[model samples]
Structure formats: structure tokens, C-alpha cells
Target: MKNRIRDLRTAKGMTQEDLAEIIGVSRQTINAIEKEKFDPSLPTAFKMAQLFELPIEQIFLFEI
Candidate 1:
């Protein structure tokens, strides 16, 4: 999957740690997600969507 995590974070002026704290994950987890090295669980995805006020599809996309 690919994501707009980094762009969104920058747009919101939020650090990885800041997002992690709001979503109850570790900064490394946020980093991994931004790098597309990790995929969040459903609830985590929902929380992230809620935080960004975007639909999940806007943030995450299937590569193929």
C-alpha cells in the first residue's frame, strides 16, 4: 500500500511523535507507516482517519 501520511503530517504541522501520541502508538510505528513499511490495524486506521479528518482511502491506497 501507499499513503499520504508524510504529506498530511507536514500539512498539519504535526510530528510523528505527536501523531503517535494521539493515536496511542509509538513514534517508530508512525515512521514505519509513513515509510510504507508497516500497515496499521483497522482501528488504528480509523483513528488515523479521524485525526486527519480524511477518509481512509485518501490516506491509504492499494498499489496494485
Candidate 2:
């Protein structure tokens, strides 16, 4: 899985800490997600989609 989390967060002027605070995760978790070392849970993905006003598919890309 790949994600636009860093791009989106930077675009919104949010630090990993900020995003993590809003999404109820650790900053390291956000970093991991951005680095593609971790895939967020469905609920976390939904929160990100809602926060970014984008669809889940737009934020996270799953390659077949």
C-alpha cells in the first residue's frame, strides 16, 4: 500500500504530530504510514479520508 499522507499533510500545513493528534494515533504511526512501512486500519483510513475531504482510494493506493 502506498499513500499520499505526507503530501496531503504538507499541503494542509500539518505536521505528523498534528495529523496524529487529530486522527488519534501516534506521530510515529503517521510517519510509518507516510513511509509506507505501515498500513492504517480501515477506521483510521476513514478518518483520514474524512479529514482530507478525499475518498479512501484517493489517499491510499493499493496495487493489485
Instruction: Kindly list the per-residue Cα lDDT of model 1 for residues 1-64, writing each as its tens digit.
Output: 8999999988999999899999999999999999999999999999989989999999999787
The window of 10 residues in a row where model 1 has the poorest summed lDDT is: 55-64
lDDT of each: 0.93, 0.97
Q: Give one digit per residue, the lDDT tens place, for model 2 in 1-64.
A: 9899999999999999999999999999999999999999999999999999999999999997
Count the clashes in each prediction: 0, 0
Q: Residue 58 deviation, candidate 1, in Å?
A: 0.7
Model 1 whole-model lDDT (C-alpha atoms): 0.93
**Residue 16: error of model 1 in Å?**
0.6
